[model samples]
Target: MTLRVYLFVFKSRGYIHIVNIFNQMSSDGVTKYKYEYIIVGAGTAGQTIAAGLPSKDVLILEAGGYTTSLLDIPILTPILQKSDFDWSYETVPQPNSCLGLRQQRSRWPMGKGYGGSQILNNMIWNVGHHEDYRGWFSPEEDYNYERDILPYFRESEAEHQPTILKHRTKLAEAFMNATKEYGYDDSFKVPHLTQRNGKRWNMAHENHENNLSHHLVLNAFVMHLLFDRTSINRVTGLVYEKNGFEFEILATKGVILSAGAIGTPLILLSSGIGPKKELINTTVTFRKDLPVGHNLQDHVTTGLDLILLNDTLGMRPWEVFTLNSFYQYFVNGDGPLTMNGCEVVGFLNSTNKSKNWDLGFMVLPIGASADAGIHFKQILNIKDNTWSQYFDPLTSQQSVSILPILLHPKSRGQITLKDDVILIDPKYLTHEDDVDLIVTGIRIIEQLIEMPSMRRLGAELNPKPFPGCENYEFASNAYWKCYVRHLTLTAFHPVGTCKMGSSDDQSSVVNREFQVIGIENLFVVDASVMPNLPSGNPNAAVAMLAKKFLSVLLQSHREKPTNYDI
Candidate 1:
């Protein structure tokens, strides 16, 4: 394919960012070549596509650097959140919940490097139940959980032991027993994650050591897609900033935006692909009048922590911090560090709600003591002592957390432009129905704690409500409402900002095929294209989209035989 490239060198802030063409050769000072495919954002979703394509013809651009050894162990997931491995996104002040947090902002930890959230997530792998995808406008379109998504899930999963849950604490056992008694399901299973032999296996592993993709560019930030802006608005390539320099690369076939939900809309808006009124203030020229950043949704959550009345119930906090604990994991992958913090989860319908509004219960082995809560507060970006209500005094006692994830929130939020920076407002629990569900979920957790099995383990609610909700009678529905309003946190599963629908859908940015409407040779393959957030974590769902995107895009590019008629 004929190609054109222009390298622009510049400096931003105090660092240098250089942009380079994938086909640029070291032997020649100047080289010009067009890539067959350009995949923006080298996260988990992008790697799924890159791994299947011919290595030399594809080029992937990632914003973060390489993966570090710290990510190899599942337990170190939290430590990587604020480190350079993370994108370090902080939300604007939420007027609704987290009232006692320092600035009322929630810290969103997105992985900046290769694996994306795979590098920072709890690593519990699930594509969600088939029912979660049953009610879509067209079940065959993208919501085929059993027929489509689950196949890809099985392909990528490795089932080896030295299993993730090596040390099943008393706390986890109690939660599982509660699920059993409550009859949420007949059997309880530990979390399924992308791991092998007790170590974290991320998406980058698909492309790095394999010859599936030729060019992998890290520390590369995509600015926007380049389009002709003619009648059809055909996309040609993209402009990116690498190191301290800016450059543009041409695509022969197409460019796919696999940037996560937040990153996808930012690039779209910056490229003038969103509602024109929002882009009027930006310098980038308008390209498409699609509702790019609308319909943003996420899984919102709140939790109940119980300081075990049984001192001998689990390992003590001091025992958890000692050197022997470290030895247990490092020397033998068989201790606290052997597992992801969330080893078990339960799915249930909230009281008086349909199965559509499901609730997820995840067990946290660490309690809210100063030592344990520090990790959570830093990750949640909670500044004040509001979370202190959940903590027990730093004594011999150990605690565990049972939090509920709000599935299918009717509440709608958005990712928009605040000046040039992306603005996120999840608008958690804005709907009365959503609040009802969360309150119901909290009640469910309470019931589980009171069950014969869980009660035997010393699980009891703190009667004193959080500080902000003290005006209401403690443990009443009103009190729980206030408590939920102040303590709400995201499950970190955001989707549907750039929605996918048929071409006539005024609100959809992309069509059922995942191609950006009103534009040619450009598509979005990440969570942004989800019509609705999946019932569980969206990582597996996003990977399914990548598979479909690759299959369709490549099939269209296949050459016709000379004997065939036009």
Candidate 2:
């Protein structure tokens, strides 16, 4: 076999010829590189875009490394949190919420490695409600749920369709029955999981291991984009760190930032491309004065307090370590380990009308007390005093938790750069309307526990008064609001920090084509570009958005070949 080595000089338009790597020498004996396209953050969106584009000309830079087989198990999701695979970020203290959590700060865990959050997230597959797409674009824009969005969702799933649970627990079935008995008609159903053959699956896992390995660079943490010295409004390439050495690489066509809601903004802010005031006194020069980290929103859930003492309908926490469970999982790919604890999901309207779902219910087969306050309490950062006074006495109890989640919270928070550290404050439950919705959800849960389907299984709300809110009368709105304040936690679906909107819309960072409004060759394709949070888990929607962006990008190239030529 003969080795063929070729080199090309990059131009303002595009490359002269295609080569795997372009090398340039400087006085320091350092090598430089360039690519047709450079995508930052090899997470869900980054992998999706890479899979669609020509892999040979594209390059992916991931801050973290690859994942192992042990972390791929669906049941091992919670253990992945705070681990090496997780970014393990935390929010600044909130005065209105997280009163019962340690230090009053909410723990924010974003994935760090190859698959990004998909490597650690509970692999639930949901496309979100159709109404969530309304008004996202202008009337003239050729984008809508049926015309553009739905087809992309279908196209993204064409290769790897979402898998249904083969072996569901008793508690999941009971929650389904309870929804029916509570007067909702056939609206609630089992969630589709992002799994194949009872194991976790995502595009990042498939493409990286099989096809895109040549294009990916793991353990490469992107520092900031390198702006063209002549034109500050344009980005030519980016600088990244790997093995404690900084490397600069150029992109001829464009650079995409799929660095997630938190990572993307942190990158832009570090590069001095944020609000005018935020970039002042920073080390880097300001390029674009836009709202880089404002309009932060997330899905916060209440009703962790809604516990059911169901002796006949709960999964034993220790059963996962049993021989039979392991045998069944390894042999037939069916067992308790296949389930991600969240076996049942339901959508409901707080007004009791059959219009749209504003509240979502996720039923776990076990409660916080199931593990005797070991995993759940630690993962959620529940206060020590709250755990001892409230949940410790009921240790190892067979119980179920029906968590009520707010789909569209009016309350908004922000992510800001303070002293070089990313300060995240979701401002959960800052709006009184958000509080009323949780109370409404709690009342629905009250009605649900009384249903014949739940009652037959000995389902009853745990009567323990929450540690911080004992002064108010039990079951009163005042008590429930206080409970909402203390027990509310993020559903892990944060969006809108870099919102997408029309050019006139001041809150928007990117336009309809996923390009940043004020900059050229800079695009954002992640949950951060969402104008509003999707009505459910955002992973599927993120996948769909990636698919749609691929089409839009390809179309833009076809319309203007010279601009995108490689």
Candidate 3:
């Protein structure tokens, strides 16, 4: 039988639609499909929730177009970093980092397309130390890693090799053995490698390829939440806009906001679900006066660039032979295609007093160009925009950038709305501890470069000239601090704008169950709900949270029917 298909593209607003040949029957004898859940933002957390949920009518609303280009999914991040897929958010003037660089806008690289940030990010899979969670929720709460969250972690992970899996088990055993000997267990199991079939398993593409029954919509921006007052504080539907025209999607059960840190809070504030004083000033009417856009946190990262004498371990052709490797991957599911760049990592404390490291180190096999700063600068539109024009003036030379992250910064920032637009003014390093932590972190990287593995690679520090370093004292702590302030940027782990906590907790926006406190049927299940930033990359934690919250939503559904009048 010959089939007819219709495709629609909205030019002015950038949206596309596909009308299939087969017409499926609905209850009203119409050829349409209705959804039980409508999820907004098909990014990291959004993709997870969509994949984990049971077989139901699910619809995902994303604002960006789709692309399957190899350039869109490059193994080395610099290629993708310069692509148009990144959202590229810039920070307001950070006084601590960038040497008083005005509007030192860092490249946020939130994927504007299908896979979300995972599609555009560095693709590093870090879970951080177990104590990071304990420190955030301990003594007062009954949240235990082994009892509550470990099984979910195991379920979600798909390790690369059996030997690697065995090594993880051995690491756990070693920690236990050390505890028996020293009467104290401080170390925790590192995160299982997040590779699928030897390739970086972007959750969006994974779902689309594996789960054919699911519906994944790209370039559909959710503009507002549709509420039914008769249902008593429940979100019955959603009002989304595509190509300048608004459409309503009725959800039989719930609407899940799995949009990441920035998107989630911005949606809430735009939907009139934020601080009373702030909402009253804007055109959006007040729905809930909760702290929707407060408690912003992100890991501050600074890079120590080192020039390598030999081609021992810096961007080699074998490391990122994309086209050939991808062809091999599709045929046999093996090769360099499976690697996520960051192979080895270490978590250590800069000071001897702390048990866990507030600083992290990621080892990249290849060195980037000295002009690497140009990629970040262009992506964020730093020069043409309001931000200061600061780029590495040095000529293009091969150098490895050792990224040191300030894991537990004391400084806090906020995301507020002005004239209905999302304004991210992350007041980075306003506190003395944040500055000190970053400084100490720089010292730690200096020590790591002295390691046998790095030394063998002939890694020599790049003595690049900076504004205040006229003396060229490379080893001096003062010189290092000057460099850190000028180079430090976000680790791409912005979180906690819509924190989850108890009612009395003034900083809390959502509750323990991930529901917005004041708003009925409104819940946030993304990185924004985190009370604090984790000590490492947040991708794993964000996915784990989505799984945990899915269970919570299901249990709540089972215990209490949605039809019941509250």
Candidate 4:
């Protein structure tokens, strides 16, 4: 017998569609239908929330399509980034960095499909310092935020304790073992392999299974939030389009905008919930005008590329495409299938006198200058000739890249509307202090590379020919600074667009509870609400926030008395 389950209808770009699924039961006569939850975007944070939520209905509205090929996994991220799955966003050319660099495209790899950017990202998991979050609220507070959040981090991780390698020929295993032994494991926990029995564990699939009460509709793009000003001034529902038709989804309880930093603010500004002056000046109907798209923040990453004496540490072409590898993945669910491009990470302050590590770095065993944009385009089949523009033989190479990331940038940018369309000016490196932090970070990495442990592995300095240095002065602080400005890019951890704080804080867009000040039943739960960028990767923090919000929701539900008499 065949069973049909009806899910909600949603809009995408400019289309509308009603989604449903049909299931065929087995001979045992036991069958279960998935729940539905309307989740927008299947990126890192989105997928984490979907996977962790309790069993209920889930409906994910993704503007992108689905992934069916192994090429979509993290191992092939360098190649997959050039495809259509990536938004391929380019920043307005700045006078500071990428001076000689072409077009200044930021290479915003927001995956357009089920797995979101997780499918195309470097996949390095680094949770920021505990003090980073608590510091934002109050510098005097001694609360153990790390202890509170560590459990949430552990909940998401699937640890692997393998024996240390001794004179191993396998590059992947050696890299993992070396990182574990070199004090890297004690700094922060690595993310559990997102593969289920060898296959990529697309969070959309897991979230759907856990949350059966809600429905996830792929290829659905939300355009605006429908608000009811006549009653309670609360958000009523969302209006979206899919398949060239428009439809409205009415929310009974509340409207939670879990869209990432970029998409969340874009949707709000489009719905007339931004700065009042801007909305009144535009064609949009004004609502709150509460600075919805202000204070944009992102981590700026600069790298030092070092050529290794041995090529044994990187992936071979045969490893990428071989019958033996595929058989191992499909049958035993092992081999290179479990690898997530980035395997080692470190977080430390550029200056030891600082409160905590402001500088963060991740180790990638492959070439540093691979075309991140072109890599995504090929995977999603987005036709474009721009791939050749950024490809340069001299700059790109097959060597391990050590990236130094500035966690707390004093420089802040903004997102505004141009004829009601999203326009972002990341405004990277605007402040001298921000630039100094990044410059100091590069010097730190240089020291790390020259350490006894790393040098023993035969690490070589990058930019074989320094622009302003003599042959012997390759690794000077000044030379590193020049290279950093030209090569540094966003870490893709944009936040603070809709900051959270007390009502008195002018910079705050939402309260500590994540509720928008002027509106009821409306909350911002993604990275956009971060008052400041964390010291490391923001994905784990985003997941922890989701769990924290759910806990508050459950506690509130239990406290309220239910009335049975009608």
Candidate 5:
């Protein structure tokens, strides 16, 4: 059992050997360490880069703990989010959106363990649109969607398209058929994700064996990024806390923050590289005037529930308590264990003419098991009355749901420093136009249910009025608009805090190559670097983003070996 350890490369008799160190040590009781690359956040993007980066001199600092073998089962994801695997972040109360939710605050749950959200996310694999790829990067940057990124998307997926789902439901079929009238061909086009058979095949799946550098540290919380006092903008070291002990590790090449949208921006602001106004109250000395926490974008949705013909008899209650279910999963790698919440998706643009991959409006299925209502209330922190009205019925009496999502919202929010955690002000439904667009989307869903195929399946809108919307009739457009506001929920897709663009763009935080503006040896390579949020779920896109950055990093290193320096 040979363990690949990371310290530094040494040439002995014309051979490079990696020396394993329990901890870099000296008689001083504390050890000083240096790596070529230090990546913050062992989330989806961080692990991807750490697994593929050519250099063995890399260290990944994950704020949370390690990902255990339990993450391999898809259904256990819900349980994981409530456990220590989650960062357990909640947003500040919103004045506009989430009027029906508890305290009107959106709870932002991010995976804190090694695999990040990939271990806990609803496993849906989607490579957004061609225009989305162009939109996400700066115009001057040559990011070839087909040549560079698309192939990687294909490389990672073992896609089980919605049409072939073995556990297909009648409601899902009806949803697919109903959308055809509105020019949506495949309402049943949900794409299964980073899984092979029934197990999760995330970016961190094979990482244990092949990671060239075993420099990955879990249970390690990065307190602050250390820079040379001699060169204020030149990032040179990282200060992190692990097991109640703190240490500073040096970096020779650079530091990358793939710590996710929320975690990344907070680190940047704390490191004194965000907007001057934002850092005014913080103790961090302002390093650059970049808008590190502005342009925060997320995909919000308005849900429309339904009552299935079988009276929810066919619903697979999110059950994991039995030995039979465990035996079924362990022996065959199939059954309820393989299900990743929802099993179908219907992606659409407003015009109803864009390519299938393009995003605009999504009528996606959010699997409604018997126990799902309980999970939603706990995970989303829904109010008791709100739960009784909206989701509680879906428990045993009703099942299957389609949420009309606001794919691109004009509304923007900001992330600021809290005492320890980051403050997320999603400002959901703040933009008037965003609310209007989603109303139009719900109308389409209302019409879709009227289609003969859907109607035959008894797929009718749940008649109960939402808790606060007792004034308007459920059938009216005005009622739906109010519904959108009351039930506004994120697709859990957040991006664009550290936007990428050329220096000419004042709002830009990082350049096309993903380098921070005015800061040397500092880069951000996660969803936060997206100039624009893609029109679809961003898990797969985040992985591709890591691949693209790794290619760039490697290529740049080859082109100018010793020049990626301050």
Candidate 6:
């Protein structure tokens, strides 16, 4: 059955500002300043949860406004980054990686608009292997993957049928064949994406007639949680700023933090619910101190390192802008515009173990150098010297790139606040093991290029040695390691900040049920709650989490009906 997916429809009476809500009074003459549940951050999880519950009893407070139609195109995902729709966050300069980027800081573009990071993502619907989620819970836990997780994934797939790329480039086809040649029998295939008829299909798109339409409040920046007056430990509601006006709204039953990994931890720290050492300097009154922002993890890749120059069969940047292509896109929803940057996905086992898909190769049909330092070079934050010296000669060339993403990195980092500034530090490749794995991945790609499928396309590697690694012998282990250090980039899959674990786990901020460890009536359900980074894109997994949590929420409401009273 195709699931009923709701869109964010902005109607005249649908949205209510904090000032307007103040005017709404109860029949008893008291101001109606309450809801049964208040969900912070109307991103992926917020939208999913709000749509599942009774709309009248729920409210979604999103900091950013709604998105535009122009942003709905699948191929336009690249341009959306660093734009107004993006939060445009940058990490603290990494000592070991991101050496090729400008300022030595990796750019982290999170979605600021309605759909959240879904707006900025490649629309890749990768749920990852079952073992990834199965390991999230302790062995003694009652969580079953078939009963709990798989249903949501199936439901999501039914709702948004993955768009097929009928005009996939020859290079993309060869990538799959190469994967099979490399002994990954299960890895040769096109990636499933959250798109329909070549356009992006997110929760914010077009089905707003549902109950969730009226409950959403755009531009409502949640400042802090409003604790219950009688018991300071339990949260009742929150104070949010909208149009420079701060207003308080109460949630009688629960206040859920659906903000992404970075936003969730930042909010917790500001509300004095994180490590006391980090909160000591802040003005927020100390509440329940937990390790909120520790254990930060993200999937880092050797950015566009395996450059494939296929002269006969690849798409160039200029070729995508023709009038015919635009007409085909708008009229038929089938054209060059339908190309999601990473058209094909292949997995490899770095440890040479069967069924352990540790390294993922996200095959991009167009190389960053194919644009000649115009569009992709700037978007990826490649350094001026690197672009001019290495990629300028390959302007508008027919090329492909198979980026090696470290599925699970041993390296860890933390997010902390210094004087209210959100300090993001995802220390990419700090561990020696992560470097070794990436080097192994590069070796696999090198082998894939030599396969008959790739060789038939006249595929050749870009021999330009990276700017800082010119001294080392080309393609040596030492040179590739240096290349990885210089060109490392994030896949933008940040998670595990507010880790969910058993009560005995000291590092846990949330319990197995997603409730804050020490705080009642407060829950966190987003990427922040993930204990480990999944093997692939996390959007689908997060949606499944919301669905799983929705069942838990409904059961709670049924068991204790009076708790939901506003």
Q: Over 4 Å off in model 4, which ranges?
A: 1-39, 42-60, 69-72, 135-142, 146-193, 209-211, 308-310, 314-319, 369-398, 466-474, 560-566
User: What total of clashing residue pairs does each candidate reach?
Assistant: 12, 0, 9, 59, 0, 1
What lDDT does candidate 1 reach at residue 516?
Answer: 91
- Which tens-of-lDDT digit does each residue in 305-404 have in candidate 4? 4445344453433334357666766677655544555556667665677777777766655543333332332332222332333223323345565666
Candidate with better lDDT, 1 vs 4: 1
Q: Where is model 1 more than 4 Å wrong at Cα?
A: 1-33, 135-148, 158-164, 211-213, 229-232, 304-308, 312-332, 351-357, 370-374, 385-396, 558-566
Candidate 3 deviant stretches above 4 angstroms: 1-34, 69-76, 100-102, 135-141, 158-193, 230-232, 304-339, 352-355, 366-377, 380-396, 468-474, 564-566
Instruction: Rate residue 485 of model 5 by lDDT.
Output: 80
TM-score of each: 0.87, 0.92, 0.80, 0.79, 0.87, 0.91
Best by lDDT: 2
Q: Please write out the lDDT profile of model 6 over residues 208-312, one tens digit for every residue.
A: 534344366776677888887777788888888777778889998888999899999988888889998768878878888799999899998874735646464
lDDT of each: 0.70, 0.78, 0.61, 0.59, 0.70, 0.77
- The C-alpha RMSD in Å for every predicted model, in order, reads 8.2, 9.7, 8.2, 8.5, 8.9, 6.8
Task: Write the residue-wise lDDT of candidate 3 on 258-324 in tens digits.
Answer: 7788888878877778899989999986787788878888888666343333433323443335577
Q: Among all windows of ten consecutive residues in candidate 5, which has the lowest summed lDDT? A: 1-10
How high a TM-score does candidate 2 get?
0.92
How far residue 151's Cα lies from its native spot in candidate 1, in Å, is 3.4
Candidate 1 lDDT trough over 10 residues, lowest sum: 1-10
Candidate 2 regions exceeding 4 Å error are 1-32, 140-143, 312-314, 352-355, 563-566
Predictions ranked by TM-score, top down?
A: 2, 6, 5, 1, 3, 4
lDDT of 1 by residue, 1-566 (tens): 00110010012111211112221221211034467778888777788877766436788888876654545767656667666667777777888776656687777778777777787787777667676655333544455666655655555453211134566677777777777788767434677766655667667865565655357677778998787645448888888886567878878667889889899999989888899887887776877798988898988887635334454533433444457767876677667656777768766655544545377777877654424454556677655566555453433355566777788888898888867889888777678888888888788877778878787877777555677878899888999888888777878888898898778879888987778998877888898888887876788777767776666656655743111110
